[model samples]
Target: MCVVTAAREGQQAGCLVGFASQCSLRPPRFVVWLSKANRTYRVALGAPFLGVHLLRRDQHELARLFGGESGDDVDKFARTPWRPGPGGVPLLTDACAWLVGKVERRADWGDHVGFHLTPVEACADPLPRGPLLCLSDVAHLAPGHPG
Candidate 1:
């Protein structure tokens, strides 16, 4: 799982995403799909950048915070330590690794939206300690948006 964050008009939002992957090799493109019903999707609509984070096995709490809670009723950022990434997107400090990407395009695909991103900046834990969290790790989480 991954946490995708965006900021707009001084407001920030993030949510867990299972539908994201590197989609291109030549020019480097990554796509993260956000549910249209999610608060993060609303903020991301006007955002210039998105922070994509890779969570380690030990960071299950971080997943629970983002995947199990709604930003519409809770400030997901307030519960986690983060810093401004490119274009002021919120980057989770506890993430195993992260990249700030510029929005190349967006597509509406039924219940979800696709964000095509171009990596602009990135940081990874120097030690590269743990295994990245996978779908099974968060399979039990009840989505904050449930869409």
Candidate 2:
């Protein structure tokens, strides 16, 4: 899974996301799927900007931090170094690559809602990075709280 951080209102939100991809090449668009059960999804509903971060292999801790906890219960940003992006979306300071996108549309896709965003601003520091975190890396997941 990859990390996609978003911000809106007075909240900065992020999660370890597995269902996302760059869907269009010409327009350079991406899609992030989120469960309706997540607080991040609720905040993202009206947000104009969302930050997509590609985690380095060493950032497994970051994944656990975001993926294992619910934002409604924890201040996820307080534990990480981040700043507001173009439209106030939180951007991770140390990600391998980051993109600030404008959310163009949202639609329900089965159990998850798909947020399609067009990247308006982006930055990268390709450091011959280690392997990226994937779905398999975080399989058999356990949430920080009991479900």
* Candidate 1 Cα outliers beyond 4 Å, as residue runs: none
Please give the RMSD of candidate 2 to the true structure. Answer: 1.6
Q: After superposition, how far is residue 44 of candidate 2 from its true place, in Å?
A: 0.1
Per-candidate RMSD, Å: 0.9, 1.6
Q: After superposition, how far is residue 27 of candidate 1 from its true place, in Å?
A: 0.8
Tens digits of per-residue lDDT, candidate 2, 77-145, equal: 989998888988988887878888899999998878999999999988856578877777777567654
lDDT value, residue 23 of candidate 1 = 97
Alpha-carbon TM-score of each model against the true structure: 0.96, 0.92
lDDT of 1: 0.93
lDDT of 2 at 79: 92
lDDT at 80 for candidate 2? 90
lDDT of candidate 1 over 22-122, digit per residue (tens):
99999999999999999999999999999999999788899999999999889888898999888889989999899988999999999999999999999
lDDT for 35 (candidate 1): 94
